[model samples]
Target: MLCYRKHSLFTKKYHIFKYDNEIHLGETTTKIKYTINLTPQTMIDWSINHQTKQLNGFWLIWKKQQKFFLMDATTCNLFKQTLNGIVTYGKHQILYEPIQSLLHSSFGSLVKMKYLNSRDSYMCKTIQKSLQYTDDDFYYQIEILQSLNHTNILKLKEVYNSNKNYHFVFDFPEGGSLADLIKTKQLQFKEVQLIIRQLISTISFIHSKGYVHRNLKPEHIFFKESNNLESLLISEFELGCRLVDFQNKHPNCRVHGYTAPEIKSKIFTQKCDVFSCGVILYKILTRKDLFDHESITYDEKMMLHLINQSDIDPQYQNLLRKMLQFNPELRATADQCLTIIDAILERTPTFSNFLDRFNLDIIYLIYL
Candidate 1:
């Protein structure tokens, strides 16, 4: 294929060539004419003066539009030697490395993809379900997730389509899920506050946007650490939806001890997410092993009892009690939780904090 190079307005050079019938022209700051695609059926005509090597002329008529572009004399001569009816350049094909290792298969639809850049990577999510549901659900989820920007929510990179599943790529945080990170140890008071603050902020933002997370659990919260600062991120939007547009009053709720009781009565509200947050907080505060799956098999009712039975520090006891309240109306909202967090943060940490006051070195010595 004939190739041309052009320095952008900023003088950054990029290879301009036709690939798969599309001219892959790109630079970091381009806002227009990024790429151009033409099918085999496309009618186009162009010629270059053999000596002058300038674009004598070119124009394409496709459907109702006629388009034309000019190439300077310098560009014309640059590709003249290999310009053999636009087919001489060797074809470049993309190869996929076989997925030999999988980090997660909870959804039974994960394919480890190639690493992309220094700070980002790609993983394929294959989604397959009954055809009864319209494909629009995928677009709706994308719309909501794309518009949402928060530290706690994972960022979606892009999406791809296949015969069976809609594959998604997300910005993978290096530090895995909270469930994976906190298995052996409990967090200090300041760490817990930082994590809870992010969760509360995430829920409140989504609620304000008319969407409900519907599923909230520790596993959904991922950990990210950089420059000695830590961050918590929420992932898995498979069940996320707009509260106003959602028609299913009784959608199946995931995560056993984390689900609220009102879900059984076909009642849905933002408070449901708050309840799940409470379950996470209780687990973090007490560092107790949550009731197991076997309990779920015997009776789901135990989950309701599990939430209320957590004996936490008295300071947070009142806030947790309000958050995990069995009655939907009595359940604390995310905004309310934020207010409580502010109050907790404002107060001096003595007995109120989950962790005892200590210098970092002393605390590490104690734990070590």
Candidate 2:
């Protein structure tokens, strides 16, 4: 129920009604007026925003362009609480019902879901927390995810806990993982540049906050929309941790080719992440897995030879070499790589046009 109304002149007060499976936002049940079908299954994107005259605003967009706004924080908060209650305890209480199982492993499965009311798709990762996670470990993970508020990093929207498993809800990238795209598309040079720049910038942000994403690979890199490389996102945080200024030693995580060589000796740091990014860059440019050979194994010499033979610009190759250096101390840092990438892009004549089309810094750039 709304205590504040946008049109106060009307004597009828605004109200919200929730049935067993649907939610209604209008004046009354007998005489209803709503922006759209208000149900948990409808695909609606909503947010709270600042408004003029010392009021907070709530806005909703659904079915593409249709929008609704309520210029009061109290109303929005109340509405959120109401929806949460229905989602948590209603008859069909599974707010995000699983639509498909995307992946399965010994630990758990990653399931694609559709929110019952809004119909927006989401990816839900179920973790068997009881087997390996303590109470502190669970809460600590939630805290870390909450703290990491970045555009490129996957955002954790909701978390649910059962007796044996923990369910985490994240925005689903319809475009799928970088690995999927690499299997099909041979990316152009400018596309490679755009992807790598965003990847390094995100890594730099994560390092600045004293954390390291131990698992940084093509499979974990996702595109928000299909065929839209500029909408890139990095996810899968099961191995990420805070470094506390490199004062503590964290456990090593190994992915065949993306893992830094130094990690093989249990010496891991922020530089390891940079090496992973470099591996991804190589994969994007060459459309080949760096070390995934069945019969013929790739030694460092062979790998270097392959990189040299690739068609990417020499500048990127040189940067990749620096990033994939065996010595941790000699590896380029995220900031340093970002600087080189920026310089390379700036030197290009088409750089300005590129920015106008694909700059992630401009928050309003949308896919046509």
Candidate 3:
């Protein structure tokens, strides 16, 4: 049995009983029993919170006695206080109803309020169902995030779990996604080069941790600032993109035309990311969709198709062919890609050489 002493914050005295991995909390001893999973700290956190309301998803103050605790109505009963404080569960009331309404109408997805930070920004996400509801997905996410620390990868702040749901809180990036930017025709060649480098570095990190980002597409690549070409941010990990997701379980990877042949056969590895990277590079270089017929004009498609099918530019064609290899084993590794990129960079002539040949202002801009 776990016992908690009433603090100055709460006026009532509450005693908690624990037996057989279950805990009971009430104002006084009662014959009725409610099944609950409790750690010593969970009951302690609940005892300190003066406010307890049904609509406000079981309330509990996490920090108490210099320790953190997880508490909800199921785990423990709440004690009443003389003063009333706002507490209710269910869907949280958004202070900016207009914004919430707009998002709801636009997305038309069920958004659950997860957490409210010190900045008053609410963290919310659409609920998703998973085949494995246990800690498999949760642990996989934690392991992947902890393994790779890069500017291009999305930042996960924390995770919250209740009896009915799980929530992931992440650092919000204002720039939207690469997919959106590509739609606006804002991505340039130099910007694409930078983005690809960052992405390769991130993929290298993931591979180092023995994981493959099965789903690597423009939509998954988030941005920090909408028009900022240098912005770096990424998000979305709900899919089976982790090592555990692929561990001994064969599932066909999905990413439209970006998916490699090995992925379709359910034999994916780090090299699959290289194939996706090639597709992304093709899009970046031409600023046209490789698959979307409506987005790419006939002339653009003809040009890209020709370049892809023929050796018009041997060097570029070689690189593209190596990346788009049908077999995973034949594709380039992250380290190999890095080396190739370095070679390409070294081969690129300086602006001074161009100026010497054509008497151009390119050298001045480069020097400046």
lDDT rank order: 2, 1, 3
- RMSD to true structure for each model, in Å: 11.3, 14.0, 9.6
Q: In model 1, how large is the Cα lDDT of residue 353?
A: 45
- What TM-score would you give candidate 1 relative to the actual structure? 0.64
Across residues 133-169, which tens digit of lDDT does each residue of candidate 1 receive? 2346556566667678777788765553334555555
Quote the positional error of residue 272 for candidate 2 in Å: 0.8
Q: Which candidate is the best by TM-score?
A: 2
Query: CA lDDT of 323 in candidate 3?
Result: 76
lDDT of 2 by residue, 18-87 (tens): 6665665576687656544433223333343323222243334444554445535566545655443112
- Candidate 3 lDDT over 88-176, as tens digits, reads 12222321121231123221132323222123333343333345444455555555665566777776554444445544545556676
What local lDDT score does residue 215 receive in model 1, on the 0 to 100 scale? 76
User: For every model shown, what is its TM-score relative to the native structure?
Assistant: 0.64, 0.68, 0.63
The 10-residue segment of model 1 with minimum total lDDT is 87-96
Model 3, stretches more than 4 Å misplaced? 1-127, 130-135, 162-164, 240-245, 252-255, 292-306, 309-316, 349-352, 359-368
Of the pair 1 and 2, which is ahead by TM-score?
A: 2
* Model 3 residue 21 CA deviation in Å: 21
